[model samples]
Target: MSRMWLCAVSLAILCALSLPTFGQTFSRILFDTDMESDCDDAACLAMLHALADRGEIELLGTMISAKFPWSGPCADAINTYYGRPDLPIGVPKGKAGIQQGSKYAEQVAKQFPHDCPLYDDAPDATRLYRQLLAAQPDGSVTILTVGDLTNLRYLIESEADEISPLTGQQLVKKKVAHWVCMGSRYPADLDPGKWGNFKPDAESTVKAIEAWPTKITFTGGGKFAELISTGKRLKELPQDNPVRRVYELYFGGNVKDRHSADQIAVMVAARGTGHPWKLVTQGHNHIFPNGTHQWEVETDNPRHQYISALADGVDPQEVIDSFNELMLHQPK
Candidate 1:
């Protein structure tokens, strides 16, 4: 080829590479949860809104796992608080097994027919997963699981080929790039005695860890939850504060209560500001008879990734501080 022609071809290739296709920042996030199970999930949903207010993340959808009976109402309450009652909210199709009669329940009901509609009739989580995953660009979505993994397991097993067209590993490599899970025990460091959320659906939790395409980060234990408290932060702001309203409603005048691990996990996934996460080891799929899920390092799993550190520990702190600051002021 002539020298001029070769130069022109090279320049064309460079320009094509430089052109932007999609402007999505930090990919997309899908928050899968059993919200009615705990106040932390509600708090986390509030924190997510705070981050969104700062233009740091994009929330794709919210799915309710089978762990909570009133998942739909809880999801609606959260959506209503965030001024996104139109966002997709999916609930489990079958029985939710657990009963609800707590402060969380009363708080969730306050939103009632307005923000929290009686949407026990929406599409199942698996169907919602298919639609969201299919519509998102390749490798641009992160499934943040803060509750039981039943919804994710259903998505993987039922819609495996459709949602993840590539091989189990390849599909994860291309479509769902990352999973931030808030379950499991941290061995000797943070024991289960410190946190009560990991006790639900241990079997499904193990299945999720095992089946997840290795690119998953497990943020478990009570360390992250203990470091930050929304009670004092919430009170620092007025009742109209978006973050405070969610916190106060869910917490119901008790602000010192520790939030959910799922909440912390989502914050880390979205911002990782104030909480320091240590990537101790890779996760496996082992399940105990008691339904307690456990994870160990595996050298063979190429599709897995446990967060060793969060941008030199700057991300977690920044996230916590930002949440505090946002809650101090009213949403613009």
Candidate 2:
């Protein structure tokens, strides 16, 4: 071949090598949740594990933001049931966090098979975040929070340790692609203390969001999420399914459908919008001192996004069906 032709071929090969391959399509998620407060968290975990089974995503670890003793074990039990028994589980050891008891966490932990017996026995979420992030390739992990932002706040404020030389903020900026938070009401929450995730640890929410170095997407259970009640179909799953038991216990044995805030957030994290949903990426999220938040649209704003309404002509049931199907998914 002529020298000019050989140069052109070499350049084409380099471009092809630089392009993303199918292996890079799957998201590596570090899931953080305030388990035990709501059955939706359980549903979210089950859905995520199912997605992992389908090879759409890889779950790096699960962190419990709730202080309840059973929260860690409940998460572990669900992870175990999904055949990921070895997945690392972390719990917040800091003072700023939620400590509420759950309607199902204790029961699920007691009835299911798991290795994490106590919340305190698990590693600190901040430390785990550092270690997990330090080990991942830069800009390859997605930090998905479906509960309080307490752990994230702790992670951002953490100092250099034996895990890595970089500080918490630096490590996050280096490793995390973006953060998907399932908190706050859409547009604005006129009621300052209404949202559980933000209100209980409002200070942490402010600290985490303010200092976060990457793009942040805030998703909520209000609006479209409230319209998508789910888990009623859990009755169809075998009694051995821990998530099914979670729904039953949460409803006092009724197993009725419930609003899906965290579940929707999980869907958005795993599969980017357009499963009948879209993202409003032009605004920034403004969190108040009292924990309520609002989205202010700015043409130049590019770091924040909020889950918006369904695409035109899309039926609400389509989302409902999708959530229910994932929740009812059989463990692989």
Candidate 3:
């Protein structure tokens, strides 16, 4: 080869070597949500897309763990509004899963400009999870949830299939790094039995907790008073923004008295505990099938912990602001 041709070949090889290896860059996230009852699910969806738009994370897809009339469309509407209408979506249409009614999903879908004509028209979340996880490199993807554990349980219990030869738990153990979620009050502040998401699908939640052989991080279940999130401010967005509209319908244009657990968890998943956020990993979480759970703090080695308050001197307002900036962020 001539000197110039060899130089060009070497340059091409260098460029190839510089490309991101599935191992490089931001965390790969597969977000699962129970969009049935909370508008924060929509807000978290917006934040994920915002992070994606900024190249902070690659949003593999979103799955709706709860079944509602227009849950899938509401998610699609947000994805479409964010200029990523082609993003894959999944939902459960099975009787074994949690089925909850949504106050906003149906209305938002009917009023929004998205292309989803039917909510259940989407694929199954379990299958989607398997296919997505199977294709990802080992310990490279993060499955973040802001909803019931039904889907997590179902996905964990899924058997080996064409997607990959690995069983559900095996696939998770081999592929997923950890689970970032927003549910179940920690420290036993409230009865774990009555915990919101866990009890709705208690059996599934228990199964999910037992099946997963990895670390699970929980955040925002009436524990972090410093991370309270409100959608009243999101109501300020112009009427065309479907996310804002979803909030309006849920909170009745009032952001006060609402928690941002789901949004904060998603933000933590995207931005990590870089500044204000901190983790309490000194202990593990204790979950039960009756919808009750608690954080067992231990000084010895432990595996689970929820999000603690802001780092020392970090204003509590900044904590919520972090969530607001991303949750209400517009697509760039």
Candidate 4:
């Protein structure tokens, strides 16, 4: 071929390579977790990063609802381990300061190879939310809250400020597509004591739940209860892996798997329904002030939905196994 023709062919190939590999656009994700207390939250973060590596989702940033000193560091360390060292970190400061003793946060932050600044050296949750939201295209963000409603409540109640010209409610309606939260109890018949996310900050839960305008998928306690597994599979991977260390710390070398709710939230958010698991839109979830929840089949509320294990093709145990498999992959 002539030199000109060869140049044209090379240019064409380069342009094709530069184009998106698939027609599907990845979902933008903002992870909110209370990683200070439970290793399940750490597991959830690992799964989310794995999904991001698969191009199934885009992990935009992380907001720590757990105010303990280690919360931000743990989130940053995990994100950094996934090769995203610059991921934004946000922390919420309540009266509960430094009450956290994460089994692996300090360890990961100090010993592991990561670059998350200081533990508490991060932006406030609302400010970071506003900054990130303002930068995103309209109707493009999906938030996953597997922790207290403290940050979310502040974001919901915030008015127009320096971050963006839109109010919190308006911003959510305009910018956020939906949110998948790990809280509440479904079926309305379960004992209130079964729920946990509501109480630590009941007022925030009520305000945020009542005010959010976009669609919400609540991954409550009942449906995802079966996502348990012995971290043995994950532990054998690598000692440098934060997730491996987390499992070791939480389980103390036990061979039995432990139930984790946050993993379900992340799983549903990334690969959403129909792969055996599906959502039940029959009714909406009701949030009480005392942090207890009941799912009432009310035609009045259509903007909310909850996860269920009753789908035709779904085997709860199989779903749990698949999620566990995702968790076992070493962080890239």
Candidate 5:
């Protein structure tokens, strides 16, 4: 071929490679969890699977944030049920203590095997976070934290040197377009107990918010997950469904009411729906001995961003309906 013809062919190939694929629109998400806290994590996992089935999001990793011996296998089993056993699961290296009065502890102990096998060969929490973030294009990733912020803190601290001049928060601000977390309260609502999955390490949470470089949107309080009740909605699925089975075993056919905060948090983080909740502009104030953290709205506070409007009213029925549709339509 002539030199001009060869150059033209190379240009054509380069253009083809540069064009984005059909699947590129979906956002990549890292689902950080502390499973033993509540059933909301399980519900959140179900929501993630539903979205993946609909091609709305790509699940990068599911790292275990706190040590709940049974959580590893429980997460693996749930992932296996969702048909995405390849997803990585990470547990805190060394930590102990189940969140107070965990109802799932006995269930997890009875159900999850002692020799809990990991579902995939994921690196430790820090490395996994770094790998996923580095692999994605800048400003394209969204880190969704539904559990404790341990893994996120690790990622921020470990990768700080790589971003230079950009602190972990700054890097997250620049590279990660959004950080959606499920913690805190609605303004001066000093009700920490009401914030279901946020008690494990309130101090860490305070530090994380203080250190966070970008604005964060939170979804929780007395009103967030108050819509979904477990009973009939969970029973709607066949026993074979992994999530349904876990639900059955844990609640024993009596799934009258349960905490849905984590699930609602996941949905808001993943889909950006629900009521317009307020954002804590001043970041975290003192975390009291009772677990509640304080916040004050500031005109130009750089530490945090509070979302006050309830984008939509709480609709557990709608959530359940969406979940059913996703499961029914999932690819064979």
Candidate 6:
């Protein structure tokens, strides 16, 4: 080979090796939410988009488990803001799920730019789940549900349809690598004890957990989420940002820091148990009929685990700073 050609090829190889390839293989994720009440869901969605921007996770689709008129649109609005305007958005079609008003869903939907149809007009969440799962490779998708289990329950119970011959449970068992849930309290949710996500759709929560075939990681951020307050940094972003609007509207014009359970859930789903989080895989989360739950020691089933703080725990401000950086990430 000519010396010039050899030099050019060598330079190319050197440059390729120098380029960063960290987290190159993206984590495939389907984010499901109930974005009608708290603002944390919106923050979580924004964090997902931000992680996608960083090439850490490939957001296959977003589904809303609630039955609010504007929740899907608000999710679409955030997706649109992050430059994925056509990302699939799904909602519960029937009146079987949580149907409530939001402090910000409507206002964010009205103010932001999105073409997603209203709740009733959107695609059914269960069907959407089946379709998304069937199309992905076996054991490749991680479902992150930071909401009521309505869609997931329907998915678990669905019969064969035009999408695939396999039932919902079969499809999920074939395709899903694991599930990361942002519901229920860890160890136990005692006393008046039913987390909002579980209580609203208690039956569904009980059923989905009982039937889900793969391992589940309950990212119970009840205590840590409160410590990891976020959303105030969103005010530093431009006024056109939908997430910024969500915080402002939810808090009555102030972008105050709110509990970050949903954000923590997203982080754990996209990235594994890193720093501050230690996985306890020795027990199973036992869900009661009323949607309340407790972690019981078990050796028979190893399909369930939950996150807890490290021995020394982590500085809350450090977590807040890191999460805010992700939440405020701009669309690339």
Best by lDDT: 2
Comparing candidate 4 with candidate 6, which one achieves the higher lDDT?
Answer: 6
Steric overlap count per candidate: 16, 0, 5, 2, 15, 0
**lDDT measured at residue 208 in model 6 versus the true structure, 0 to 100:** 92
- Candidate 5: tens digits of C-alpha lDDT, residues 98-136: 343345644654553333454233347765566566667
lDDT of 1 at 130: 75
**Residue-wise C-alpha lDDT for candidate 3, range 246-297, written one tens digit per residue:** 7778766544436777877876777664566667778666776576766776
Poorest lDDT segment (10 consecutive residues) of candidate 3: 16-25
Distance from true location, Cα of 174 in model 2, Å = 0.5
* Tens digits of per-residue lDDT for model 2, 109-164: 99999999597677888998899899999999998999888999999999998999
Q: How does model 5 fare in lDDT?
A: 0.60
TM-score of 1: 0.74
Consecutive 10-residue window with the lowest summed lDDT within model 6:
17-26
RMSD values, in order shown: 6.4, 4.6, 4.9, 4.5, 6.9, 3.2
lDDT of 5 at 311: 43
Q: What TM-score goes with each of the models?
A: 0.74, 0.91, 0.86, 0.85, 0.74, 0.91
For each candidate in the order shown, give its overall lDDT on alpha carbons: 0.59, 0.85, 0.76, 0.75, 0.60, 0.84
Tell me the lDDT of candidate 6.
Answer: 0.84
RMSD of 6: 3.2
Using alpha carbons, what is the TM-score of model 5?
A: 0.74
Per-residue CA lDDT of model 1 for 129-195, tens digit only, reads: 7777777788888888777766776666553555455444344546787788776545422334443
Tens-place lDDT per residue, model 4, 1-332, is: 79999999999998666542232346899998877777778888888877777767889998888777767777777777778878888877544322345676776677666655554566777888989999999999999998888888888888998778889999998999989988755666335555477667778888899999998988856445643443456755666778777777676654346666787787777766445555777877777777777888865477888874546756667766777777876655
lDDT: the better of candidates 4 and 5: 4
